[model samples]
Target: MSISFLAKHPVPCSLFLLGILVLGHGAYIQAKAYLAQFLIAQAWQQTLDDQQVHKPWQWADTYPVAKLSFVTKQESIGFKHQVESVYVLAGASGRTLAFGPGLVLSGAKIGEVGNTVIAGHRDTHFANLAAVNKGDLLQVEASNGEILLYQVVNTQIAHQSDTQFMAPSDDNRLTLITCYPFNQLSGGAEQRYIVEALYVNKPSAI
Candidate 1:
């Protein structure tokens, strides 16, 4: 039926149509959030939490860097983990090595003896991450059940060409990365935003 004709019908019909539109939009958003959460949690469980197949790096171990599941937001699903590429140290143009949804980048490795650098996709996997603010608690779930806590220290923006954002620091650090101009349209993100956190003492796992 024509929309205008339907609108001319009884009040009940108009109310019902409005209800459908509202409910449908609500359902779509809820479903999308659930799916994102499920995908990320599953990835962490299967790859990082699998006792028989995977083990996290020891606190004393160094090198390739330990991949840990990062959870925040106090939400059912936090976000994906990623591995930091040592090559990010190599002149900045090389692609930073990373795995999606299941690995935490060891910030202790990016510079000569400084902050560890890590990155994640902003649109699908780390969208809610933009909500993360300074002082938000972050947990890095390792296979050993030892979850490390980090406190957000700062957040900033950098161009795609600004490699200094990934430069190693003198202090122990954690950097969470996602595409920037957070309000921009989907097709082309013009910049990048980074949330830097400091490694506080280890906290109990959630």
Candidate 2:
């Protein structure tokens, strides 16, 4: 190969070389981490747009957008909703970006009248969540350009089998759940990091 060609393809060649080296040592995990960052970034924007546009409350009903914060080093990534599901897991089924990402939680579907629960992976995807804390500002932008702000109220670590994290509530609340320990390497963990957000108020239509 020409020197110029080698120079131009350095990154791709280095990535290929690195891939071969780390193929067995959490290669998929590392790759997924990089992909998850991009995927979540895009999903965040789209979800916010759609939420503001349709305002799910107008037609079928949906939850507000989710936002990332570093207010607490123990909180998880945040999102909003009206109700909770059973348990959320990460997989390959939602929107596809590069090489088919997967169905990561697309914000909690607005429930009738309760807290909306959303979940994701902690170590890779929600690593930044560890900095989220009470009183931290969360700005969820809807599809229709509406901005929903939330305030972090609490943080906790629930058991792996704990379903109370997804429980219903009397107030318009938001819950973010992820694997506990922040940086688990054995895949599954014994606990989950939960961030509780209280609805502060909606910002002006954006």
Best by TM-score: 2
Q: Compared to the true structure, candidate 2 yields what TM-score?
A: 0.53
Of candidate 1, the 10-residue stretch with the lowest lDDT total is 85-94
Q: Please report, in order, the local distance difference test score of every candidate based on alpha carbons.
A: 0.53, 0.53
Q: Flag regions of model 1 displaced more than 4 Å.
A: 1-113, 202-206
lDDT of 1 by residue, 1-206 (tens): 67787768868787888999999999998896565445434443555445433212223121222333334444332332432211111111112122233223433542224666666567644565677766556555443445566767788888878877567677767777778866666756768888887776642223
The superposed Cα distance between candidate 2 and the true structure at residue 140, in angstroms, equals 1.2
- What C-alpha lDDT does candidate 1 achieve relative to the native structure? 0.53
Q: Could you estimate the TM-score for every candidate?
A: 0.50, 0.53
List model 2 lDDT by residue over 9-122, tens digit each.
Answer: 998878877888787668777777566545545544555545432221223122223343333222344443322111112232322212221223433433223576656656
Candidate 1 differs from the real structure by a C-alpha RMSD in angstroms, to one decimal, of: 10.9
**Candidate 1 at 159: error in angstroms?**
1.1
